[model samples]
Target: MRTISHGISKIEKGISILLMFSMAIVVTLAVAFRYVLQSPLSWAGEISVFLLIWISFIGGSLGLKYKSQAAVTIVVEYIPENIKRMVMIVGHICMLLFLFILIYYSFTWILSPSVSYQKSTTLLVPMWIPYMAVPLGLTFAAVHLLSNLFDIFQKGESQ
Candidate 1:
């Protein structure tokens, strides 16, 4: 479980960083081409937008793995340790439920005929490619949370 947690941390960070860097480069090039060179690339905007969508998902998973999401933890901070452990378990359970729902609906949505047929304007790629990000990202986050839960319950550790 620790090994899986460690591996998720490494891969999540690496993928998020790469996505961020790619977004920056792609958007920069699009801006430069549109304003300076007077040659706007049609695919540039679409591609950049696609990258941004993916970055949000991949980066969001990393945020889950690291517990970097925003929270109002003032109340929890003052709670007892055992109670806190219970709260943490409940919290992770809720997130897992949410991710499961996300994965289910997103997967089905992608399989739907209309959504599967839809394509991007400039890139002309199937819309499912972008929609797939929902399930993929949520799945990653769910696994990370499960890994954390294993450590918490079995090893008596906090996330």
Candidate 2:
């Protein structure tokens, strides 16, 4: 299980990094073309937006795996060790529930006829392609959350 989780984490990180680099390059080229060459690439803006969407979603999953998301840890720090563990487990469970709900609705929204038929104005790509980031990212986050909850349980058992 850890091996699979680690593999997924590595893939998510790689995709996030790639999307970030691609977004940077696209924006740079867009700027150079519009300002320096006096020719604008209409699709560049749309492509960059798509890349950013993917990056934001995938990066969010990475944050879950690393427990890097922002939190008010002051109160948590003062809690007893066992209480803290309970709190962590409960927190992760709540997050997983939220992610699952979002994932369900996101998929429903993506599969609707209107959304399915729609396409980006500049890129002419299916709108669902970009909108899909929501569910996919949330699914990855759910996996990470489960892994984290498992770790918490394992630690509690060992102690």
- Model 1 C-alpha lDDT per residue in residues 1-159, reported as the tens digit of each score: 667767877887787788788888888988999999999978887887777888888888878877899999998899998898889899999988988988899888889999988999988899988778778888888888898887679746433
- For candidate 2, write residues 55-94 as lDDT tens digits: 9899988898898988889999999999999999898888
Query: Distance (Å) between predicted and true CA of 147, model 2?
Result: 0.1
Alpha carbon lDDT of each predicted model? 0.84, 0.90
| TM-score of candidate 2 against the unseen true structure | 0.96
Kindly report which residue pairs in candidate 2 clash with one another: none
lDDT value, candidate 1, whole model: 0.84
Q: Single out the weakest 10-residue window by summed lDDT for candidate 1.
A: 150-159
Worst 10 residues of 2 by lDDT: 1-10
Off by over 4 Å in 2: none
Poorly placed runs, candidate 1 (over 4 Å): 155-159
